[model samples]
Target: MKRVINFWSLLGFISVSAFLATEIAVVAAAVVWGISSLFGLAMVPTIALGILVGVPSLYGMVKATILAFQAETDPENN
Candidate 1:
C-alpha cells in the first residue's frame, strides 16, 4: 500500500518540535554557563562555552526534523 503523510500536520509538528528543541537547548546552555561560572570561569568565556553546546543542539534539532519528515505516516493514525 502507498503510505501518505499530511503536509499540514508535518509542518505543525516540526514547528512545535523545533521550538521545544530550542527551548531545551537554551536551558541546557544556561546550565552549562552557570556551572562554568561556579567553577571560576570568567563571564565572557562561559557565554562562549554555552554557544558551543547550543550550536550543536540546534544542529541536532535540524537533523531530527529532517528525519522525522521522512517517516512513513500510518493511515490508521490519521
Candidate 2:
C-alpha cells in the first residue's frame, strides 16, 4: 500500500511538472515572438495569436496544479 501511494504521488508530481514546463515554454515563446515583432519581424499577428492561445493554456496549468496539490493533501478522498 505504501509503495502504491508513493508511486501515485510520484506520477502526480511528474504530470504537474510536465504541464507546468509546457505552459512556461509557451509563455516564453510568446514573449520572444512579441519582442521580435517589435523589431519589424512581421510576427506581430503571430505574437497576438500566441497570446490568445497561451493565456488559456497557462490558466489551465495553474488550475491543474492547485487541484493536484489539493488531491495530494486532502484526506477525505483517501
Superposed by TM-score, candidate 2 places the C-alpha of residue 53 at a distance from the truth, in angstroms, of: 0.5
lDDT of 1: 0.71
Judging by TM-score against the true structure, name the best candidate: 1
User: Relative to the true structure, how large is the alpha-carbon lDDT of every model?
Assistant: 0.71, 0.67
Give a tens-digit lDDT track for model 2, residues 3-75: 2346677577668767776877777677767666676555676677677767767777777677776665455
Per-residue lDDT of model 1, residues 1-78, tens digit only: 544667875776677677767776778777886789689888787888788877887787777666555552445445
Q: List the residue pairs that clash in candidate 2.
A: none
Alpha-carbon RMSD, each predicted model: 3.2, 6.8
TM-score of 1: 0.58
Clashes of each: 0, 0
